[model samples]
Target: MRSANPARHVSLPFPRAPRYGPEDQAAVRDLLHAGRLSDTSRGPAIAALEDAFADLTNTVYALSFASGTASLHGALRGVGAHPDAGVVTSPLTWISAILVAFHAGSFPVFADVEPGGVNLNPATIATAGQASAVLVTHTFGIPARMDALTAVTGVPIVEDCSHAHGARYASRPVGSWGAAGCFSLMERKPVSGGEGGVLTTNSRTVYERALTLGHHPHRLAAELTDPALRPLTSTGLGYKTRMPTVAAAIASVQLRRLADRMAASETNFARLLDVLHAHAAPITTPLVAAGSTRGWYGTPLIITEPVPNPAALFAACTAAGVPVRPLYEDWLSSPLLQDPALLHEAFPHVRHTGWRPPDPHALPNYQVARRQTLLLKVPDVPAADYMHQVGDTLATVLTQAIR
Candidate 1:
C-alpha cells in the first residue's frame, strides 16, 4: 500500500552549500588588492593547493587548470591521443566529456554505463575494440570498478574525478588509480570556486606534458619539478588554461575544509538514502557499493515503475519545492546530436554515426532519455531536520504518483 503525504503545507529543500569562511575571503581580497590576479602571483598558492591535494590523495604530482574540460584536454594530450586513437567514454555523461576528447583531436566513442550508475562498464568498452584510452567518470560520487576496468583492458585510463574528489574505492583514492586524474572546482562541485580544475598523476613524463598543455612555462615552479623536465622548459608550448590566482586561492581554502564538508554531506546523503530505500518500490535511490566512500554530487533517483508523464513528475517535484529534473534530457538531442552547426566550435567530430551501439554493456539506449530516469539535486548542504523533511516529502509525493 502506498502512503500519502501526512504533513500538510510543509516544504523541504535538500542540502545547501557551506559558506566560505573569513579566511577564504581575506585570501581572495589579498590577491585582489595585490593586483596579482593571474597565475603569476597565485601560482604559488595553486602549487601549494596542488601539493596538498597530491598529498591527500597520496600521489606524486598535481596540476591546476582553468576547468575540468581543460584538464581533460591536457590529459588526452599528455597521453598522446591522436585522431585515429578514439577515446571511449560513457554516453550517460555530461557532453563536456565528449567535447574534451574532440578538443584534444580524438574521436569520442560513447559507451554505456554500469547498472549502478558508477563507471563505464569495462566489458562494453573491451567489446568495442582498439581505442587509445578510456576516460572513466566516477558518476554521482560512486567509484567505478577501476580495478576491474584497468585489469581487463591494458589501455591507459584517464579518470574524470569531477564528481568524486576525495572519494575512495577499497581504501585507495580515485585520482591515484588512473594515469591522469581530473577534478572540477566549479560552482556546484564539492570543492566550489567560481571555476577551476585540477589534474594529478605519478608519471613524470605525463606530468611534464600536462604542465605544458596547461601553460606552466616549465620553469614557473622550481620546487615542484622532475629533473627530466628541465630541458623541456625551452621547447614547451603552452595553452592558456591556467587557473586564475583568485579562483585558486578560493579552491585552496575549500580544500582545507574538504574533509569536514564531505563528512557532513555524507551524513545527509546516507539518511536520505535510507528513507528513500525504505520506499524503494517506486524510486531506486542512489546506491553506494561496499568499500566505496562517495562524494555525493547529486542524489540520483531512478523511477523503477513507469510514470504517466515525466514532464508531470518534474512539475510535481518542482511544485513540491524539490527542484528535481531529468538528467541530461537533451544531451543526445541537442545541437551536438542534431544541428552540428551549434557544436562545431566545441566538437568537430559531430558527424552522425547512424545506428552504431552506444554502450557495450548491452545497456538499453532510449531515444528520449527523459522518460528513463530522474535526477534530484542534493542541497549543497541542508539542515538536519530539513533533510528529513525532503526525504519525507519526496516519499510522500512519489507514493501518490505510484498509487
Candidate 2:
C-alpha cells in the first residue's frame, strides 16, 4: 500500500511547459495553418531549422528526423555497416541505442561501461576487437571519452547525443567530435519538442549518405546532389521518419534557448548534489570530465552498496512526496523485448542479435549503478528559487530513506 500525502510532493508541480512561450505557440500556429507539414528539401521552414541546428552544433550539415532512434539508424547506414557486421555499443543506454543497429541490419555488440556511468570505455572497446564501427552514447549528458575512443577503435564513430545537447569535451562540441552526432528532442531531454531528432556531421559525404538512408527525397532546394549517391537513393526505401513541421518548429524555439536552460539546470543539479552529499546519501554524483561542460538530461548517481534495492528506496521517496523517477528503472523486466510478435516484426534477428542484461552482481559498473537515483525535471524557464524546494525535498526524503 502507498501512503497518500500532499505536503510531501515528489517534485515541483508547475503546470506550464518549460522553455515554451508565445513565440513557440506562434511558430506552431504558422506551421499548422500552412497545411504543408511534411519535411521537404524545398520547405523553407525546415531548411531554416536544419541550418540553425547545424550552426548551433558547429557542423557543416544537420538533418532532421522524427526521433533520435531514426537518426541513429540512419547514421549506421551512412557508415556502411552491413546487416551481419557487428557494431559495438554500451548496454546501459536506452534500448533504442541497441535496437537502432538491429534496424540497420547490423548486429549490436555490447560493451561494458566505465565507473563514470556514461558509455563503454574506449579501452574495453579496443579489446572487443570484433566491431566494425563504434556507436558511443553520452548517457545522461555526460560526454564519453572521445579521444580514447577514437584512438582505440580507429573506425567510424557515431555519437548518440540523445542525452547530451550542449555538452562538450575539451572545448569541442559532442557532435563535432564524432564522425556523426545525433540528438533527441523528446519530452524529457534538454530540448523538448514532444518528439523530434537531429543528426549532424562535418563530412559532406556522410551527411548526403545519411539523408538518403533516412529515406527522404531530396528537394532541389536542399542542394544535396552527389553523383555517387543517386543510384543508392533511388533503390533504398526510407523509414518515413522525418520530423513533423510542428515538432521542428517547437524544437527550433527550444534550441534558441538551450544555452540558458542548460546553465540553470546545471546549477540546480549541483545544488541537489551538494544537498545529497551533506545528507550522506551514500551515492556518487556523476563526474564531469575535465574540459567538459555538462548539459544534464538526468542527474545520475552511483550507489556503491553491493546490493542496493533501489526499488525499496524509490518507494520510500515516493511515500514522502519527492516526485522522484528512475533513469532507466528495472528496464530488463520490461516485456516489449520478449513479446514474440513485436520482436519478430520489429527485430527479426533479436534471438541471435538481441539485447541481454549483464549479470548485475558481476558487472562492476552495474553494481555501481544499482544505487538509488532521482530525476527532477528542470523546466525550460525555471522559477528563480525553485531549486531551493527541490533540493530541500530531495534532502529530506533521502535522509529518511537511506538506511
Candidate 3:
C-alpha cells in the first residue's frame, strides 16, 4: 500500500533549536552574576532588547512580554478593546490569536482568508459588519495585503508579526503599517530566545497603555506622565506579562543574526522551489504577493493531485526522513468559538448575548487550503548536499504517491 525509501535521508535535524555562542553565553553569565534578573531592577539586558527591537522594526516603542499570546492580549487591551466590541480576525491562525480576544473581553468575528492566500481577504473583512478593531496575521511569513485592508476598514489594526518579524510589504516593515505589531521569540520561530515576545508600535498612547498593562505597578507609575493617573499605580489595571532578562539576552543575540539567517532560508527555499519546478513536481509552493518579502518560516506545499491514500504518502515521507506534515494539522476546529461549553466557562458574557458559532464549512478557501497543504521544515542554512538530497527525496516520494 505504501512505498518506503530507507536509503535516502536528510542530514539536517527537524525543528533545530538555536545554538548559543559566546555572545549569548556572556550575556546570560553577566545577568546571573549581577543577580538582577528581574526587569524591575533596571535589568540592562531587557532594556537593551526593547531598544534594539524598536530600532530594528522602526517603531517608536517595543515592549517585551512573557510570550506571544501575552503580547497579543496586551496589544488588544492597548488598542481599547472592550466587552461590547467585536474584533475581526482571520480564522486560519494560531488558536492564541482568537483566544486573546476572549482574554480581553472582546468577541472574535471570523473572516475568511483569500483564495490561494493565507492572509485574510479585505473584501471578507469589510463585509464582516462593524468591528472596533481588525487583526491581520502575516501567516507563515508572507505579508498580508495591509494597504488594501487598511484602506477598506476604518478601525484600529494590529499586525500579528509572530512569523513575520523581518518580513516586508512594499519595502515597509510589517509592524510599521498597523497601530501595533506583535512578534514571538519562541523555540520554533525563525528568531527565538527559547521563549519570549515583543510588541512594537508607533503610537505613544498604544505604547503607554501596553506598558501599563504588561509592567509592574510601581514601574508603570514611574513611566506615567499624567500626575492624576499615577495614583492608580498602586494596583495596575493590567496583568504581569513582562519578559525575563535571560530570555531577552538570548533574543537580542538572535535578532542581530536574523538578516543572515533569513538570507540562507530564502536561498534554500528558492533552490528547493527550483528543483520542484525543474522536475515538474506535483506540489505547489506558496505564492508571494508583489512587493512583499517573505521571512520564510516554513515552505508550504500544496498537493496538486488527489492521492488515493494520503497516509501512504506521509508514511513514505517520514521513512525517507522528510519532515512533511499536514498544514495546521494540530487544530481540528476553532476553539472556544466552536465549543459552547468552553466559551461559556471562559467568557460568561457570551451566554447572555446568545452567540452563534461560525460555520467552518462556509470558509471554503480555508478548508481547501487546510486539506491540500503540507508544511516542510527547512533549515535556516542548509548544506548544498543536503538540499540536493531533500530535493531528490521529495520528488521521488511525491511522484510515487501521486501514481
Candidate 4:
C-alpha cells in the first residue's frame, strides 16, 4: 500500500444544506410579489404544500407548522400523549422526541435501540409498559423496522420523519405507516424549506386535534369537520404555529424536485461505496432494514473489522481534507435527559415522568456505534461525480492504516 496519495485526493465539501435552485428562487419571488402572506388562513402556498406532502405520504390530511418540533408536539398530543400518559420512543434520537412528550404533558418512556441498530428495538417498546403513544424517528434517514414496531404497540404511532423525507419501510412511505407522521423541513433535511414542518395523518380526529394545537381558529373554522370541536374555532388552543407562506412556497418547489434529488444522491452514494471498497478502507455503509430505502441525509459510516484506530482515521481524514467527522454524543446518556432536577428547575408544575434511564452497558450496539461513527457530510444536491473525489480523499487518508 502507498504511504500517501495527496496529489490524487478529492476535495469534498463538509455538511451544508438548504440548497436553492432557480425554481425555488422563482417561487419565493412569486409569493413575495403576491403580497398575500397571513396567519388568518392556510395560505395558498401552504395549502399546496400540505397537498404535496399528503400526496407524498399517502395520508388524508397534512398540516403545516412553524417548525418540526411544533409539528411533533402536535402529532403526539393528537394521538393522546397527555399528562401521566407514557410515550414510548427511542432514547438515541433528537431531543425533540422527548421534548414533544413534555410538550404533550406526558411521561416519556425511554426505550433501548436495537442491538446493531440506531433505531429503537421493537422488543424494548413491547416491554416499555403501557405507553399511550409511540413516536419514531427514522434516525439519520434510515428507516426503522416499522413492521416490528407496529406489530408490538397498539398505541397510535406518530412518526418523526424529520430525518427521512422520502425514506420508506416495507415499500411504503415512512410518514404514512403510523397513525400520524411528523416531518421537519429544516435546512439540512432531505426535503427542506428554510425552516418549516408538516404533520400528516389519516384520521379526521387526529388531523383536527393537531391543527387546533398549533394553527389558529380561522383555519379551524374553515377546515374543522367535527361538530363538537367547532366551538373552539373562536380561539383554537391559543397557540399560533403555522408555517410562513413564503417558506411554504420554497418548500413546495423543493418537494416537486425531491424524487430527482433522491435518485442523484442514491447514485452518488453507491459509486462512493464502490470507491471505498476499491481501496479496502475500513469503513462500512449505513444500516438499513429489509424493504427499506433511505433518503441519505448524511451517511453515517461505521468502522468495523481489521480495526484501524478510529481516532487515527478521523485525524488523518481531517488533516487530508476529507469531509468526515466524529459522530455526535449519545442522546440516551446525555445529562439533558437524565437529570430530572433540570426538569424540575425549568418547569415546577410538571413532575413524575416515566423517564427511566436505561443501563448504558445494555445498549452495547449504540454505544459502540456512536463511538465508531464517521459522519460523511454528503451534499443535499450532490455535485456531479463529486463522490468519486470523496472516495479518493478517504482512501488516501486510510492508506497508511488500512495496509
Candidate 5:
C-alpha cells in the first residue's frame, strides 16, 4: 500500500525551479515603474536581451519570441521549409519539435538516435530519404555530434537548445553549430524568464525572415527595403510572437548569472556520477563525447537490463520520496503523433500531403533506449550531504529492484 504522506519520505520536490532573488525583483519593479508593461515594439529591455543573448551565443542576430514553440515556428519558416518538404529529426525529442515542422507546412520523418545516447544518429539521417532540412535536439543538455551531422547532411540544421543552455561541442557553443538555434526561457529551463524564447542566427536572410515572422508589423515594416510592401505588413501574416518586455527584463538578469549556475551544476553532477560509479550499480551514466562539455539538465540513469516489472521500480522510488521517471517513454507511440484525426484538426492544411506519422518499427535504437533510460532531478547546486544521500538512496533502490 502507498503511503498517505509522501512528504514524510522525501526531502525535496522532484523538480523545482530556481528561486528568484533581489535582482529579479528589482528588474520587475523597474519595468512596473516605467509604466510600459507591454509594448509590441522591441522595447529597450527586449532589445538589450536580444543583443546580450546574441553575444553570448556568438551569433550575429538574436530575436526573442513569446515561447519556444513560437521561436521554432519562425525558425522552420525562416529556413525555407515548405509544404511536403521532409524535415528529418529524432523521435526521442519533445513533441513540440515535431509539431513545429507540421505547423511550418513541413512533414516530419523519423531518424534513429544513437545506440546508447539521446541524440539523432548522423548515419540514419540519410535513410529518411531526401530531407529538405534537419532539426537537431541537444537532448537533455548533452551536445549532439554537430560537426559530423553537418558534414554528412548538407541541408540546413535548426538546433533546439532549450535543454542545453550552457552546453558546448568541440569548444564551440551548441547554438553556434546550426543555421539557426532556438532556445527556451520557460520556467524549468536553467535561465528562465517565466515564458520566453530566443532564436540565434548568423545569416542575415534567416534573421530577417524570423523577424518578419514574429516581430510587430511596425518593426517588420521598418526593415523592409521596398516602401510599397511596408503597408502589407499590417496583414495578419506574422505570428505576433514577440517576447514581452517584462519577461525580457527577467531573462536579462538570469542570463548574467548563467555561468555560475552552470559551474555549480557541473560540480554537483560530477559528484553524483562518482557516487553512482563507485557503487558498481547496473546502470549507465550519461555519456559525454570527447571534447564536449555537457550541461546538466537531469541525471539520466540507463538500466543495464530490462527489469521484470519496471513499474515496481518507479513505485518504490515514489514511495521512498525519490522522484524518478523515464527520460521519454516511446514518444512515437503517443496518440498526439499517431492520431490522424487529431492531427488533421490541429493542422488542417498538412492533412493532404505534409502529415506522415512515423512508423514505430523504423527506429530500433530509439525503441531500445527509451525503455531503459530513467531520469533523476538534481539541483543546480546541491550540498555535499544532500548529494551523498541521493546517491546512496539511488544505489539502494536499484539493488532492491534487481533482487
Candidate 6:
C-alpha cells in the first residue's frame, strides 16, 4: 500500500538504524555480570579490543582512549610535538586535527590540498616549511597518498582515521602507513564504540609514550618497559583517558562486523552510482582517484556543469526524499592561520615560533572541490529495494531540476 509518489514511497533510514546486533548486547551484558562497569585504565575488554583492532589494521600496537581528540593528543605528544615543534596538515579537514596541535602547545601549519581533491598535495608540503610532525586526515574515507607524502617529509606522520575503518590505499590499510594512526569510535564512525578512540602504531617507544600520556598506573605498569617512561608510571602522566569498559564492550562487537558492513555499504553506494550514471547528468559522480578506495565517510557528487539554480537542485533532491546536501558551504578553515594578527594574538606558541601562514591561494584545488561537491547520505543498512527508490528519486529530481 505504498504511495506512487517517490517522496512518500521512499524509506531510507538517515543516521542509520542502531547498528548493534545481539552480540553487541551480549558484550555489554557479560561486562556487567563481571562487574567491570568502567575501568580507569585500559581494562580487559579495552585491551582485547585494542589487540583485535591492531590485528585488523596490520599494526603492532593499539592503545585505547576516552575520545578521538584524546587519542590524537596522545599521538602528537607521543611523537614529540612540543611547544617548540610544528604540526602541518591540510586545512580541508575536521577542526579537531588542527585543534590537537594547539592542545599539545605546538604551532599549527597548513599545506594546500591536491588539485581538485581532498587529500594534501605532496609537492606543497615543502612550501609549508619544516614541521616537526605531519598529521594527515583521510578526508571522507578516501585514503591520503601515503607513499607520496612519505617521500616528501622526514618527520613522523600521524593519521586521523576518523572516517576510514576498512579503507585501504595502495593495497595497504590507511593506519598502517603512518607512525601512529588514530581512529574515532564515536557513534557515527564506521567503528562505533558509542564513544571511544584507538591509536595504532608499530614503535614500542611511541606505544608506551601514548599509553603514559592518558592511561593510569595499572596500564602503564604492565605496558611500559622503557626506562625513560617508568618514573611517570605512578600516576601515568595524570590524565584519565581510558575507553569506558562499556564502550570497549560495544567496540569489540562493532570491530567484528566492520568488514561485513563495509561490503554492504559498498554495494548500496554502487547501485546508486549506477542510477546516477544512466539517468543523471550535470550532477556528476565522485572522481575517485586511481588506486584509492573510499571508506565512504560521505558519498559526494560534484556538479560537472553549472546548474541553473544550485539551491533549486538541492531543494528538488530533498523534496524527492533523496536528502542530498552540500558540504563546506564556507570552505575556508583556520582563519587564524591566515590572519597573522589573530594567529599571534590567540596562541603564545605562534608568537614564540615564527610560523607564517601560507598564501590565500595555496589551496585552490580544495576550494573548487568543496564548492562543487554535494553530499549524499547513504543507508548504512542493506536495504536494497529502498536504495533503488532513493536513487530513482534523485535521478528524477535531478532531471527535473535542470529543466
lDDT of 3 by residue, 1-403 (tens): 1223422566665533347778888988988999967776235787888898888778898889999888888888788876666788887788888768777777777788887767888889877756778988898888888889999988999899998978988888888899999999898787677898999999877877777776887677677665645665766675778988989998898889888878877777777777667667788766677887887676677788866676677788888888775556423365756788988988887765424687777778777667666677776765555665677778878877787
Steric overlap count per candidate? 8, 9, 0, 0, 0, 0
Candidate 2 at residue 402, lDDT?
A: 60
Write one digit per residue (lDDT tens) for candidate 6, span 36-142.
88786666898798998899789999999999989999999888887665798877777788868877778667888776567777888887866889999987787
Structural similarity to truth (TM-score) of each candidate: 0.86, 0.86, 0.91, 0.90, 0.92, 0.88
Per lDDT, the best of the predicted structures is: 5
Looking at model 2, report the run of 10 residues with the lowest lDDT sum.
1-10
Predictions in order: lDDT: 0.71, 0.70, 0.78, 0.78, 0.79, 0.78
**Residue by residue across 1-403, what tens digits does model 1's lDDT show?**
2235433223644445446779789989998888888763235777777887798678898888899888888888877776666788876677788768777776677666665454587778876556888899887677888888889767788989888888988788988888989899898787866798888999777777777665755444543366755665654556678888887888888888778778887777667667666656466644566787877676566677767777777777777766565566445445554555655545555343222323233445432233646676665453677656666777777777655
Clashes of 1: 8
| Candidate 4 weakest ten by summed lDDT | 1-10
Q: Compared with the true structure, what per-residue lDDT tens digits does model 2 show for residues 1-403?
A: 1112312443556323535679889988898898867865547666777887788779998988889888898788778765545788876688888778778887667667786465677767765546667899988777888888888887789999998888898778998888899988888777777888889999888777777765556642244578877765544455677788888888888788889878776666666566556555566756677988876776665554432566777776666655456667433344654455665676667556434433334445644564534454554445434555555565555555565
- Which segments of model 3 are wrong by more than 4 Å? 1-18, 226-231, 306-312, 329-335, 352-354
For residue 175, what is the lDDT in candidate 4? Answer: 93
RMSD of each: 3.7, 4.5, 3.4, 2.9, 4.2, 3.6
Per-residue error at 42 for model 5, in Å?
2.4
Cα RMSD, model 1:
3.7
* Clashes (candidate 3): 0
